[model samples]
Target: MPLADWLDRRTGWRSLAARARADLSRPVPRHVNALFALGTVAGTFLAVQVATGVLLLFHYRASADAAHGSLEALLSEVPSGWFVRSLHAWGAHLFVATLLLHMARVFVYGGYKRPRELTWILGSVLLLLGLGFAFTGSVLPWDQRAYWATTVGTRMAEAAPLVGEELLRLVRGGEEVGEATLGRMFALHVAVLPLALLPVLGAHLWLVRRLGVSTLEDADVEERVGHARLCEGGEPFFPHHVLQEAFVANLALGLLFLLAILAPAGLGPRADPLETPPGVRPEWYFLPVYQLQKYMPRSLLGIEGNTLGFLASIPPVLLLLALPFLDRSPARAPSRRKGAMALGLLVLGLGGALGVLGYLSNRTVQAFGRTFVFDDRGFPERAAGPATEPR
Candidate 1:
C-alpha cells in the first residue's frame, strides 16, 4: 500500500470518529457552551508545569541541606531560570483555579448525572491530586516559611485521630522533617503522583468521548435545531479543534515564560528545624483547610475534636466522588435543579467565608508573648501605657 493511501485511511477514520461524535442525538458541547474549555485550560497548565518542573529538576538537589540553596541559585544564576520557577508557581495556581471552576461548571450543568459518574469521580480525584501536588511542591523550596507552614500543616494531619500519628510518620518518613522527608516529597511531587494521574486522566477523557457532552436542559431544542441548520457544519478535530488546542497550549507556555522571566520568584531563608516562624501559614490553596482545623471544637466523643473535623471531610469527599451517581436526575441545566443549585451556592458561600476568616485569623499579630489586642475598629491599638518621658 502507498504511504499516502495509508495516511489517507487514518485521517478518514479520525474524521469518522469526529463526525459520529458531532452527530450524536446530543453532541458534546464545546468552547463557551460547556466546561470542556476549562478542562483543556487545566491540561495545558499541567503540561507547562511538567515541562518547567523537568527543567527545574536539572538544577534542583533533593538533599535538605542543598535544596533551598540550589533553588536560590537557579533563580539568581541559571539563565532565565526565575521565569521557569515563577511560571511553575503561578501555573499551579491557575491550574487549580481553572480546575475548580471546571468542576463547579460541571456540577451546575448536571454533567455528573447518569452515565458520567466515573467522569465526575475522576475529576474529583484530579482535584485532590492537584492539591497534593501543590502541597508537596511548596515544601521543596525548604525556606523558613515553607518549613514552618508545613510543620503547621503536618500538625493538622497529626490531629486526625487514631491513624493521624501513623499518617504523619509515613509522610515525614520519621519523627521529624529530615533528609528522608525531603526525598519522599521530591519523589511524590516529581514522579509518583503525576504517574498515578495519567491513566485516570486518560480514562476521564475517554469517558467524555463515550458519553458525549451534557447540554443545558432548558435550552430550546427547536432553536438548537434551527441554529444547526444555519451552520456550515462541523469541522474535523485534527485541523480545527486540535489546532486551537495547540495555540492555547503555546499561549500558556508563552505566558509562563514571561512570568518566569519578568517576576522570578525568590527563596526565603533556609529552614531552621528548631525555630518556629510567627504567623506561619501554608500555601493559599490550603488556607481554608487550615482555618477549618482552627475552628474545630476542642474535643468530641472523648477524642480531640479536630479528629472529628478531619473526619467531617469524609462526607464532602465522598459526596464529590459519588456526585455522578447522586445527581442521577435527568435535569441538565442549573435552573432545573433548585436543590443542587442551593447546595452549590451554600458550598461556595462557606468556602468564601472560610477563606476570608482564614486570612483574617492569620493576620492577628502576636507580640510580647501575649495575644495582641485589637480595637473595636479592627486596628491594633497600643495597650494603655504610662506616658513616656521625653527622650
Candidate 2:
C-alpha cells in the first residue's frame, strides 16, 4: 500500500485510471452486444500473435537449410517452446477467422456506410493484410506444405495481366522459392507486415473513437450537423459493453489453448525443391479460388483461365472498395437492402461450398450414411461402398 501510494504520487496513476474509466464509460447503443465485440476479439488475437511470434523468433532461423530444423529444435529442445509456437500458429488462423466474422457482422449491419466509410476502407485493407500475414507466415517454416503452397501461390500470382512476372519475382525475391524467397517471406512476416498493420490498426481505432460505433439505426443515413446518433439513449459502455467483450475474449482464448493442446502445429518434411508432394494446397481461405480454377478449362474464349480468373476478381474487389459510395440507399435495414444482402449471401455460400469441396479433393468421404468420391474439380460421385481407411 505504501509503495502503491508512492508510485501513484510519482507517476499520476490515479489520474490515468480515472481518465481511462471516464473514456470507457461513454454511452454506446443498447443493441451493442457480444456479437459487436468481434473487433475487440480480433485485436486480442493479434496481440497474442505478436507476443507468441516474438518468443518464437528468438529460436527461429530464416534460411531454407536451417529453418525447419530450428523449428524442430524449438519444439523439442526448448522449454515450453511448443506452447509458444503452437499459440503463434493457432492464433494466426483464429485471427483471420475472427477478422472475417467481424467483417461479416459489419456487413450484416451495413456498418460501411456514410461517415464510417473510411473506417470500412481501413478494415478492408486490414483483411488483406491479415491474409498476407497468413501466407508469409506459412512460408517461414520452409516445410513441404509451406514450400509447395508458396509455389502454388506465386504461380497463381503470374496470372496478373501485365505485371504478373514482376510481381512473382518481387514476391519470391528471385527466380524461384529458394533461400532468398524464404528470407523475403521471413522479413515480410516479421517486419514489413507488422509495421504496416500497426499504423492501419491505429488509424482504424482512432476513427472508431472519433466516430463512435455505428448502430443498426443509422448506418446508411446522412450525418446531421447537431444530432448525436451514435450514442443516443444508449447504455454505458464501461460495464455493460466491456463485460460482454471480456466474456467473448475469454471464450476465444480458451478455444485457442484447447486447439493448441489438442492439435499443436506440426511441421512437414524440410522443403524439397526437387520433389512436389501429392495433394499440395494453399490455406483454407484461398481454397475456394484455387478450387474454382480446377473446375475451369485451361483456356476460355481465347483467354488463359488464370488470367481470366484474375481479371474477374478485380471488379468485385473494386466494387468492395467503393461499396459505401455505390450503395447509397439511405436505409440500413436488411429488408430494404434485400438485393445487396442476397448477393452477399450467395457469394459467401458459394465460397463455403467450394472450400468444403476443395478439402475433399479426389478423396472418398462418408457422410449421412453414404460414401462419395470427390473429383479434383470437387464434384462428387457415389462410391461403391464405404472407403477403407489408409494405414
Candidate 3:
C-alpha cells in the first residue's frame, strides 16, 4: 500500500535495500583502527568533488578561447561560484592526499594478500585515475600556470620509448596545446575519465564488500607478537565503525571548507604559447617524478637520459602494483616483515623528500658571473640576468 511496498512490488527495491543493509552491517576486521577511516574520508571528498564539479559544468566553457574568461566570470560574477569552485579545487587535493594515506595504511598492514590482490590493484588504478583527473583539470582553467604546467607534463610523455611522439599527439590533440587540445581535455575531464573512474570505483567498493576487511591476525602478526596488542574480533560496520567514519568525513569536509574560504583557488594570466614561465612544474603529486627526471643525466649508457629516467620511474610503480606477487610472505607485522617495511619506507621517504625538494626548487640566485636556479635541479648556468623577473 505504501510507496516502499509499491516500489518493492514493481522493481524489487526492498531486496536491493536489504542487501545494502546487510553489506553495511557486516563485521569489519578488529585491526581496522581509527586510521582505517581515511578511506571513508577520501570517499567523502570524492562526493564533494563530483557535486561541485557538476555545478562548475553549468558555466564552464570548454574552449581555450573562452575557458579562462568563463572561469574569471565564475569567480567574479556568479553567485557563490567562488565557494563551489574553491570546494572542487581544494577537495581534489584532499582526495588525493587521503587516498595516498589510505594506500600507505593498507601497504603497512600487508592487506594486499592472496584474495585481496585485486582490491589493491583497483585502489592503485583509482590513484592513477585521480592523477588523470588532475592532468585534465589542470588544463581546463586555460590560465598561464595551468597551460605551462600541462605543457611540461605532456612533454614528459614524449620520453616514452616507441610511441612517445604519438602519445604527445594524442594527449595534446596536435603538435601543441591549443583549441583542439582543450576540446579533447574537456571531453576527457567531463566525460571519459569520469566514466572510466566511476565503474572502477564501483568495482573497488564491491571487492571490499566481498573480500571483507583484511586482518593483521590473518597474516600471522598477532601470533608472532602477543595477542594482547591486537583486537580479538571486529565490531559491527553499522553503528560503531560507521560512526567513526562519519566523524572523519565531517572533519575532512570542515577542513576543506575552511581552506576554501581562507585560501581560495587562483587564476593566473591567460595561456600564451609564445611566453614560457621561467620555471614551470607539474602539480605536487607529480613533482617526485619531475625531480627524478631533472636529476637524471643527459645521456645514460648512450640512451636519452629522459627516457631512462622515465623508464626508471616505471619499475617502482610496477613493483607497487605487483606487490602482492613480489612479497609472498604472510607476515604483516612491522617487526616481522623487515624487507617489505624497509622497501615501503624507502619508497615513501624518497617520494616525500623529492616532493619537498621540488617545492623548494623555485629559488634562484646569482653569484660569480653565474645564475643558479634551484628549480633546474640545482643547475648553474651563465645568463644575462636572473631566470625570473626581478621584483
Clashes of each: 3, 0, 0
- The better-scoring model by TM-score among 2 and 3 is 2
| Alpha-carbon shift of residue 263 in model 1 (angstroms) | 3.5
**After superposition on all CA atoms, what RMSD does each candidate show versus the true structure?**
5.9, 2.6, 4.3
The digit string of per-residue lDDT tens for model 2 on 90-158 reads 999999999999989988888887778899999989989999999999998888999999999888778
Clash number for candidate 1: 3
So what's the TM-score on candidate 1?
Answer: 0.81
Superposed model 2: Cα runs more than 4 Å off: 1-21, 219-222, 225-230, 367-371, 381-386, 389-391
Q: Compute each candidate's TM-score over C-alphas.
A: 0.81, 0.92, 0.90
lDDT by residue for model 1 over 1-391, one digit each (tens)?
5885698687876687667666543422343332356778889898888988999999999999899889989989998788788988889888888889889978877778765678889989999999999988888999998888877777767766678999888888888877787888899998999998899899998887665555444334423554333222444343465556567666766776677667767788999998887667777677776677666678867877778778765777787887666665677667778888897898788777766666655354455554544432234555434433335
Better of 2 and 3 by lDDT: 2
Local accuracy of candidate 3 as per-residue lDDT tens digits, 99-186: 9999999998888875688999999999999988978888899999889898888888899888889999998889998898889888
| Model 2 pairs whose backbones collide | none
Candidate that would win on lDDT: 2
Give the Cα error of residue 168 in candidate 1, in Å: 1.1
